[model samples]
Target: MNGIEAPNRLAELRQAAALTQQEVAERVGVPVSAGQVSRWERGEQAPSLRYRHRLAAVFGVGVADLGIPSAPLPRQRSSAEDWFVSDEQDPRVTKSQDEWRRTRALLNQNRHSLSQVAADLYPEHRLAGTGLIAGGGWIPEQPVDLARIELSEVPDAPEPVLSGGEREAARMLPDQTLTRSYDRYTRAVRDLAPPRLFEDRVSWRLLDVDWSAGAGRMSFGDTTYFNAVDVFEPCAHELAYVALDADGGLAAHPHMRDLPYRKLIGSPFDFARRPVMPAISTLTIRRGAGDDVSFLLHRRDPRAVAAAGGMLQVIPSGIFQPSSLMPAGRAADFDLWRNIQREFSEELLGMPECDGHGRPVDYTSGPFAVLDQARADGRLTVHCLGVALDALTLVGEILTVLVVDAPVFDSLAADFVERNDEGTVVAERFPFTEGGVRGLLDSGSVAPAGAGCLELAWRWRDVLL
Candidate 1:
């Protein structure tokens, strides 16, 4: 095939493989942009010999099958052959890396502002003094029963159907933005590997919540971690990419002009369009006596985690999921306190995460036993504050506070690690006082659910203490 026909054929191969331009760019063994792939596919630009070979490998085809000649074209020659050139040596890769650096900086700078805009857009769900939204009368200070949360098996939950505009945008734009970001993150954090097992792990999707009977009555359906990552996480990044203008001003992307939360408000329980996954965020307070209380905070390492990176969050925050994929494990792990115990183990003690592949956790032994004993002895109190949805990502959070008496906290504190898989503990525990809580809120670095939990815990200190 000629040069023009060869480029056109590349597009057909990519479509046949069911891959996006971004995915193709990522798998091409180089740091290239989706736009570059688009240009190559449209015949607006030609791939160098090195790229052509890499592209052939990515598509699992021979060079001839890709319709590219084995020999380099006369016009493609430079001072050095393409095969000898490293990613760093390629000016295109350098430019793409530079752009990514700028984008990361911009995201870090404007994240708080974007969150505020999200909160404003969903006023009805917005909780005061926090960048969170509580629904179903579940407000901070209200306690929920762990037993009341019900789970329904959804073995064949249908995938959400995108609007025509959304589908077109998904088709044209890069779909692997979050995955690419995650790749960059894992590369930077040597110890952090891609969550290959965790992605396929089963999760509980929030179907409905009712609080009319005092405590929260929640209904959940089976979902998977891959679903949240594939659908909602990318939507969050897409909003950030398109909504933020060159000058850092806010404007909605044409495809996502409608608010996701607005569409679901009328029938929040319906999981046909958006399957919300609620993360459990607990404010762990160490109470010594009358007014001597302190709370732990975590600065999530941006390079290690996918969401809420670089933000101050309540310690021991994690998705509400089972420890094992076994049906028995799923049934037993549905309790809120059990999930919190796992988070405490992973985030605070630096233990290996419960990746849903291991045997069912034995709450009768190890750290779980210690925590369970403390709760039984009345030395630890776990309370569910409320449930809220993040305005930007439409992700849900079950806000909670776990107050440990001095002796129990001291025992656990002795084993607390400086850093865990997710992040490091803020150097010292902040006093659980109005001033301390106010300082964190004003700093604009706290995660929405963390802020909500802190505010609510402080507000109800009289009752909790």
Candidate 2:
């Protein structure tokens, strides 16, 4: 065994045995403190081999039963210490670590300037006021009718073809980069538990987008979450570092020179060379008659999430995925509105996450049913403003807006939470005025996709309001 499964039921077992932390510590026959035992139970720390064996014996169970590996714990490197253990001591690991550090520093220093580079790269897709790029003609000027947007799943979607240079660059990438990146994330956010890298979790990969006949059509295929983390995330980091470098830019960056796929940064619509998994980002608004319009924003906790940490984003943003792994669940969740509803439940209502391993969700009843009825009665309106790729990450975003009548919003507001799994919601709603919206766009802390959605929503105020 290597790393132990997360969130061990040590507390449960201790209670079942009718023992306190101090009692358990004494039974271990070592200098263990109650505090140390508490850490072990909470998964904040792991026990040594001797402690593991002693604790298992004290609990009257095998090491494996206590969520402790039977094998000796591997020696940890301080620089790359993480919950997930890596036994390799290769030079490539050190190189990857150095590269990650450099990239992280560059991003921190040049965070505000990223939008300029994005506009320069994809001038055609860049929105007029914001630094976001909309593909497939899903621009704010031409709002997509919710009825015309179509999403179809393609189980046998062909894999994207990589050019010779892209393949070579991929080969040159260090195997330990991804692990080391996750380690860095864990270290930065020590208070929050690290996220499990579910490599097998199915995600909807955008195969293609078409808008030739005045209707929006998007085709999707299934891809693993780890695939995006492995390929796109690092690529985005390296590209950002290279593009923002003042010394020599792309020509001078050592890693950028090897990564020919960096050229694809400008081509937002070319899904042939890489996978593009979009997150559904909705700008939720509460509106009444004249002057009674307010929007919600989320301040993402830097210590909680790996991406877009400490940034302002539209409320209720999440990846486009099914609630359950069943085929029926996937078919039922293929709608844009369903994905948004799930996000609203999780991010707004503080509901438990639907992580795609449970039973299929029944959309005919519960809160989902209430939302459906509201939409049917014209008390709720949902519209797709467009789809945009982030300037820094190149991660796709399905930009949308949800407008609910003041009465409906007030009823739901009773259950609204101040914080969720991702971060804190700005408790006070901001008025949907031109000045307020422009201030947020200029704040420099807003995520590109969020800014784009806000801009589009403001543009369509006449219709949306």
Candidate 3:
């Protein structure tokens, strides 16, 4: 039989020590001929385990340092999926549908426990779990005239229908989120990171808002949170892309860390029950002749994952930013109005003069100009209908009710089609009744923000229709 082949440091060590094969054999107590040594050097023969140690000792090295190839070690678990422990005869077997359902139920039952575990495990991250205290101490400088609509009368949410995979993905989200506090009295947020895009800012004191009432409020207090900027590495945008690519979920991109911090944990940015972040929802109502009021509605593009694919929403809705509103220290109290105008200009009118992303663009035809002319002609009137919070996302909405006539609606819609080239918006039309709003909600296609907008709009049905 041929000699077993193996790579060893016999040749290199012998040369370095200025010793011959015979010398090494004598040192190791191996009764082998020099011809056998030559064969071993050529990987034509290997020594026994005991002899390997003796040979290593003579070479002033360990057996592993001899450069011999050993059997591969077992593959280590290093991904988020690795944390999902499984018990089965075949470890590679995929989970069944019933098993996934059971997994989801178990996760929900132990959500608080898991959150606590996460908090304890990542103390450096400052995770507060479900119990957090935020937003106390601060007062409003000036009174806000916006009418607060009571959402207590709103119906309870229907049971959600989610796939097994979707439920599992949702279980992976964190119980905390990010918030930016501008002093103890005011908590602020920007649409973009680095937060240096705009100059004017509006601030409301934390103590001014009442948190006892749900959904509609000027301020909120909840702190079980963490900064997305801290937990997500490289950038949050890259993390967003990966979440969309893999699970259609919004997750923080995890990176490899040093020992003891070796695991790549997903971020708790989107899923956290943090402080309420502000957004603007404008309901453009067109009154035709007598009492006929038709409200404008738009469908989001299917490619937009933020809305969970395509969904029906108001004509123009966007988050409020300190940079975009309150610029040059003028009209600071009118920040909500300014945000609504910008949303209209970008989403409905399709004007390139304004932008959603932080790119610098001048407003050639601003929203105020339309508001001014409409007010002058007595055809359009905008009213602030208060703020509401989303239960699932924890984001607050500033509802702006716009009353417009048919001529103005037609003019704006025509302008939107002409100015639009990018398919950011798929379609637009007028839905005149509360039934339309209810239909979208029942379809389970409207996003949480969109659903909030519809609820606020429904409250104005008496005047709208």
Candidate 4:
């Protein structure tokens, strides 16, 4: 009748006929079992187009009697010009076309449509009431209140479901050199070498990792034996912890504390058995020309020793550091933005490059300064779009949308690329179209975290747009 949640009369008709779902399935010749028919009755899945006619014939009613508009067969015309004439001449066709346009508008306006939201949040999972019927397209009949949507956590009432996609993505990483080559960074990235100098920077404690297989709960330990050839795994349970910096700031050293026995069973490329950690994936979108929005991501150089090399991914994604959880000083404020900006500079701005000698240079202050300038000029705005908790990982994303004048965008683009080239970052761009976003999603070069961030940005385009 409206969205996917609107009740269909199929169940009522079946009961009236004293027919079982199996009988209906047999009469309709649909390959699915009786349970699927029950799903349609429960408003879980809409019947596909191929089965609609069968249902109508079995129920001895028109398709419209099943709560869907009946589309007339196309008119057979003598000439192509006659087709246009026929369309203009037919009131039913014209009315149907108008109704379609109005319905499409309503669908777009209803940002909280249950089926659409389900598609966005759980692309990996298939719900009962949503599928593509030929004439009906994909029907999702549920209506939801946008205000009641959960942000930080999954719902306890309906329960969060895990699909196979998460495990698939994690397990399907391509085989490559897994170890980080620290020696290779001695020249260019000498300054950025992770300083495990202070006692607080490294977590010596072993963390127990255990939780419901599908829920966001996960376990992490320190990265004691992280090697260049080893891949990161998100196992069901593993010992891991956050890496910190000297001043009690977040260092984000991509190492996890894993026991030898746990490490033996996990392949770096497989994520099925890896531990999940508290982390953030940031999308700093910038408003571009009218009706267009832009965001930047960078590709890591293949030669770089960083975990994600030769990939176009979220340039600034990292786990929550110790400083965020426990500030060393009273004056230090707990803020995620501080870490996000730090990562942005470390990856995109390329501040960690070395001087003529192999000694480290100071590029630490650059990201902060740029952000401050952007804010002062009214070019920055930040939003927490909410948490995306999938089987592989649980992360809170901070969407920072920036609106810059043309002159500033050009200047920033040039500087961002030039600076990051010396470090791990190889290329950068602001993708602004659906095709471009899809390319990133399909790219094997995008980091998993970057891929997840890109997906969240695209699926939540309604909020950003």
Candidate 5:
């Protein structure tokens, strides 16, 4: 077993035991401390022979069922001390040449034993018999193969079959809640790995939103290529999920789409190996928040986004998100905002009476504007975001409101919520501590526009015959 997989297996076995660390410690005859069992299960350390024997007896399995050497009490301490250490990172301790040859012979024997066990226990090994319980461990009696029995079969698998211990395991598995948080909280990280060797660039289209020009699926390299098409004006903070799959020759949509870690982590095969072929993720950031800005998103498919120094930054026109200094009004100077309907109308007819707001009540309403005022005990606190949107601009779209408090502005600007056209929300941060929301541009400021972030809407120009 790889050293890493040990923790995962111990957790599974512990759960099957229907015992808590406190209960398991008691049953295993370990010291009084409950945490010792927990630390052992976590792969932080190992326990003693007394504990191992106790665990095997209680679980009704061999000590090797846990996928590690039995922790026997030292016999002839001087001699065995040179063989192996319970907790040393280095396997090579001082060993005389004679002991080395003996150790190698024992290891070769163990390897053959493991090979036979693997052949018996694994269907892929094509061994004879029921092919189960091949793990070589010191046991007073025959050991059990827990995986060979499915939970659904427990009720009907013969009368006196459970051996008391298996029944205890079944009971414990249902109620056990032992846990370990895999969060690596170290904020400072150094590159022992090359930057390019990291996850390569990838793209993803919103699956449910539109699967046709669907984002390109994972190919040979690690990439989730995407095809971004413009959609209707999006909501302020409505959330959505992002899912991906390793594109296979099969043309069917999988029932288990959210492949990564989630409540429905699917079957044991999902986490036990390869953690499912694909993964699912989510973001709280909304559709139209400016950080996901892609001019191509407003036109063609957007380039895959990349990360550097632990932060994901948007790249526009094949350029990393520009630090073009904070805007005078905190927005790009270019008027990326447009009125396409007017252009369409110009191509089709002479002129239209409707105003930019698509209203007839008119710009004739003479200097129209809305102001916000907040008050305290006979005093006024000056609060302003310094920009405004023309009041008549909103007609067919939703407005994320954060109107400036100015006494004389005509437009209504909003607290922008952002998303790609497919509606997969772009988030500013994930729970990950090291490589989260930083490096993305400063989304810390406020803005004024019906959509304060980025304004995205489908645009098409057709020539009349």
Candidate 6:
């Protein structure tokens, strides 16, 4: 194991310390960003023990706490498929146990040499695990004797993956995941000691736009009864990312608190430049049925338990699907939105809505939308910051104008305009179906913004009411 990522433990540290990226950087005397913190939590990056010591110092914790030894070594490696958590047996995490022993021995012996290596690798950098420059567990103050030390890079397992394990685990995996398994973990998360010091910031920007033609409005007649309002502003270019657990509650992982307060909860941010998404990504695993999540392991190694520590799987069923009806050109429409946003404005709308997870259609571009040439006067502009499960990263947010009823649309075809000048939206009566989303009753009037988005509620509940 050359690189077993410990997202869970890393997240625990950040959460326990309650330090923001800038705070962590300053405490450790290094320059770091929230993005760097995210990479650490995502298993995309790693900090040497020296840096880890610095992190420990900043958090007022011991270096050993930062190390949650549960990984394979050089002689042994487990792919995502090889690991599994079985009810019939305890996970064979002995490999992690052995590695920790080796690491401890090496650290005690060659602390100075390793610190020198780390300092060379990161000049002006302090230890992360110890959060110290030189002292007990510190490099210079208590250098590990180079003569007796058998130093080497800590061996780690390959990143766990669903690999082909998803297939085999399916055989033994349960259909519905019980929340009980996550309970003790949740308690551990809640008990993390708070950080001693932290500096934080929140940044936001507006996404300017140009209104255009052929743009229409959507309204809910029941919106009047329920007091639907323009809950969010559309000026921000950032989005918030929220993870959900198997039991349908928010993921609310502890490490997120370390993000800049503005982006603390994946809230939102404003940006001037356009955000680009991956051109193409192949889904290693497709959607599964309820509780079918049992088979969802990386190499059947049970190490996923550790990975899931700070991260979320973004299981297909866990996503929030706003709209049930599937249209053929939704993918095409999203492509157009991306094209227009990238080519014209940085807005991410002008297309159908998307569930936070995988697209109903194969990946085309992204979960972007816009507020450009697609708006009119009566349109209510709402700004929002959100995050995508598959793509990762917060959107800071984008502006979306909900034109209750465009005058042009009414003029072009009164029947098509759901919300008209009369504060009423004509319904496309599905005389045959009892409860169908056909038309609005009187949804043109704006209500006050509530704690949660009334607009989102109106859009979804309109179908039933």
Which candidate number would show the highest TM-score if scored against the true structure?
A: 2
Write model 6 residue lDDT over 1-465, tens digit each, in one string: 249656546677766655566656554543445565565566555554334444554554554666633331222212221233321212232222223223322222232232223223222433222111211211121111112222121123222121112232122111122321212211111112112221111111112221213122111110110010001100010111212232323344323232222122222222212221111100011112332111110111111111111111111111111111244433233332222222111111123323222334433333222123223232312222111111122221111112212332233233222221111221321121112211111121111111011222224222212
Which lDDT tens digits does candidate 2 get at residues 375-457?
Answer: 99999988888777775556778889999999988888889999887789999898899998999988777877788889888
Give the C-alpha miss distance for residue 48 in model 5, angstroms: 2.0
TM-score of 4: 0.39
Q: Measure candidate 6: CA RMSD.
A: 26.3
List the candidate 6 regions with Cα displacement exceeding 4 Å: 1-207, 210-395, 399-465
lDDT per residue (tens digit) for residues 1-465 in model 3: 158544667788888867788866655542545665676676655554334544554554555666654532233422321332431212111112122222322322232232223333334432122211112311112222233322121123222121112322222232112221122100111111111122222322111134233223443221211221122111212223232323233243233232111132223222222223455677777778764666766665322222222445565776554332324422332345556666777677765524322443233345557665776687876665444433222234555677777887777767664222222454544465667766765655555555545565565556444
Q: Judged by TM-score relative to the true structure, which candidate is superior, 1 or 6?
A: 1
* Sort by TM-score, top down from the best: 2, 1, 3, 4, 6, 5
10 residues in a row with least lDDT, candidate 1: 188-197
TM-score, cand. 3 vs. native: 0.44
List model 1 lDDT by residue over 160-197, tens digit each. 55321343224212212223332322131111122112
lDDT of each: 0.67, 0.68, 0.42, 0.39, 0.22, 0.25
lDDT of 5 at 405: 22
Comparing 3 with 4 on lDDT, the higher-scoring candidate is 3
Relative to the unseen true structure, what is the C-alpha lDDT of residue 9 in candidate 6, on a scale of 0 to 100? Answer: 68
Better of 3 and 4 by TM-score: 3
- Candidate 1, superposed: residue stretches over 4 Å from native: 1-105, 145-172, 175-198, 247-270
Clash count for each candidate, listed in order shown: 0, 0, 3, 36, 16, 83
Candidates ranked, most accurate by lDDT first: 2, 1, 3, 4, 6, 5
Q: Least accurate stretch of 10 residues (summed lDDT) in model 4? A: 131-140
RMSD of model 3, in Å?
21.8
